[model samples]
Target: MTSDISHVRSLTLDEALHENPVGWFQYRLLLMCGLAFMADALEVSLLSFLATCAGADWGLSTAQEASITSVVFGGIICGTMFWGVFADKYGRKMAYLAASTLITVGGILSGASPSYGWLIFFRSVAGFGIGGASVPFDLLAEFLPTSHRGQFLIYIEYFWTIGSMFVAGLAWATLSQQGWRFLA
Candidate 1:
């Protein structure tokens, strides 16, 4: 009986938000979520550059280099399933923040890695954090009015392209001149 009331109340809240005019809340959400998307893309772009640099610096074999890069994908696969469940049990915002933190810590640790083995471990950690894309993709839509949701989602996606370009330029400017550790 009470459960039914809870469900209806939740729907009512969603209804009210949908009816609300487009304003700062929606815009702010767009900015934050877009940044997340951009960061995810940047991290992915950085991987190839970083992996190549690491390979040369560490004198790694082709298979070892590939393994270092491929491990991140494995982590992402596991993290998606893990983070999706985590968001459902906890909340999207919480999961997103946690994932962002993981990405940051993992990235820092990866940059500081002394060997190929450590790099593989840290990159996988970052990849796991990357899997928490649920919040950016799903949460934004829930808050947005149906009329504007499509445009906003599209806007959010544009950041990915920008991030890739930014990384490419950054890599071009620095990777050739500096050591991998500096760029990493």
Candidate 2:
């Protein structure tokens, strides 16, 4: 009697993704996602620097300053909740693009703001974009193979620190001689 043997094996999504080595696509994804974090950090910290300049240039009161900051965070809270659900239903890519566009528009409009109220509104719009920060992380995590996932995530966080530093450097270069509007 003779016996026949089979030696084919198949892998599930998790198994295949987890076992694969990091590649160019993963690197590009990491870079893009890291940029998202950097943008978030920049927008979040920008308010502190801009608020001071705006107060001085516009002669705003303490209550106005507080309202500006509060409104931005409030918008962030609402955006995070709404965008998270939107990302789940629509897609992370769409949510990411929408958030980025919002941030850009908000920043531009804030710079052009004629009054404290407009500044607050634009900053809130920017904050809404900032709230979608988690989308990139979620999308990136899904792509990363398990082997380097943890380390890559930590690396992505460094981009945020870099963004904070970048904003400070920008403020130092532009804030003293120029108005806050230019910096934004």
Candidate 3:
């Protein structure tokens, strides 16, 4: 009986180690989350650049352009709350995937928008995804060990900034010649 118990305990430990696999599993998860974060940041920066082109091309007044930006932010605020609750109830992976999908779809739609109003609507939809994805940052942080959690979280922020810069550069390159529709 004692030998059997020892064998079972050893097997359970082996299984756990295999499941985690030298911390590679966590790293994979982190990479996925980081990519999602990058996408969110890219969408935001692109929207800002596109707003300028949209205003100029559409002959929108300054006030109208400002309103469009405001509407998107407002939608983001609402989305943050909605996503927070959903994240708590559902798993992190599911929430992140859903948010990413929304952002991608919203970005494509926003790029293809013919009018300022349509752009604002799509931007708002993207904002919702951003808001939902934001909650996962905290969840990810919690999953990491104390020694590494802060570093990983900081890396996420860093990646987001990098993504924003990348998008900004792309905007400058594309918008300078072909205009905003090139973004689509």
Candidate 4:
């Protein structure tokens, strides 16, 4: 029989993935997911620095400072639940956009907080956004070939260390002489 492209057999999803070569698209997906993970890590690590500087500036008691952390964690818990369900119902993309919007708005306003109450409120907002960390990770993993999934997932996790280090450097550079708002 003469060769013909029309005779090509359809590959199963697994077969297709295994047969396909890794390329820029996969690499780009990894970069995007890793950055999202890094942002999540940086925001979580920032909790202590913001609380300390704000506490000193505002004369907040130890319990009050601790409350800031508590509220953020609380928001994280709630957001994880809400976003997970939202992702399940609407879509990961929609949930991610909503979460990102919250993070941007909340984090910026956090720096502008004038009182302990406002600080906690904005941190809660950011924490809620941070809770959507799994969305990008899941989205990336779903797109990656099975062979590359584990390695890429691990690489994505390394962004957390990078984020932690980044936050520390930021605090060291500006926390001492700067206003809480500036360091925030």
Each model's TM-score, in the order given?
Answer: 0.90, 0.92, 0.83, 0.90
Candidate 1 wrongly placed segments (more than 4 Å): 1-11
**Whole-model Cα lDDT per candidate?**
0.83, 0.87, 0.76, 0.84
Best by lDDT: 2
lDDT of 1 by residue, 17-102 (tens): 77779899889999888888887887788887887889888899889888877988888898899998998899888888888887
Q: Which candidate would rank higher by lDDT, 2 or 4?
A: 2
Candidate 4 lDDT, 48-154, residue by residue in tens: 78777788888999999999888888988988989889998998878878887887788889899877888889999999998898888877777778999898889
**Global local distance difference test of model 2:** 0.87
On a 0 to 1 TM-score scale, where does candidate 1 land against the true structure? 0.90
> How does model 4 score by TM-score?
0.90
When 1 and 3 are scored with TM-score, the better candidate is: 1
lDDT of 1: 0.83
Error at 166, model 4, angstroms: 0.1
User: Which digits, one per residue and each the tens of the lDDT, describe model 2 over residues 1-184?
Assistant: 9655556568876688887788999899999989988988888888788877788788888888777778889989999998899999999999988998898899889999988888988999999988899998888888877777788889899999999999999998988887788877
How far out, in Å, is residue 140 in model 1?
1.1
lDDT of 3 by residue, 71-108 (tens): 66776788889887787799766778888888888888
Better of 1 and 4 by lDDT: 4
Residue ranges of candidate 4 with Cα displaced over 4 Å: 1-12
Decreasing lDDT order of the candidates: 2, 4, 1, 3
Which of the two, 1 or 2, has more lDDT? 2
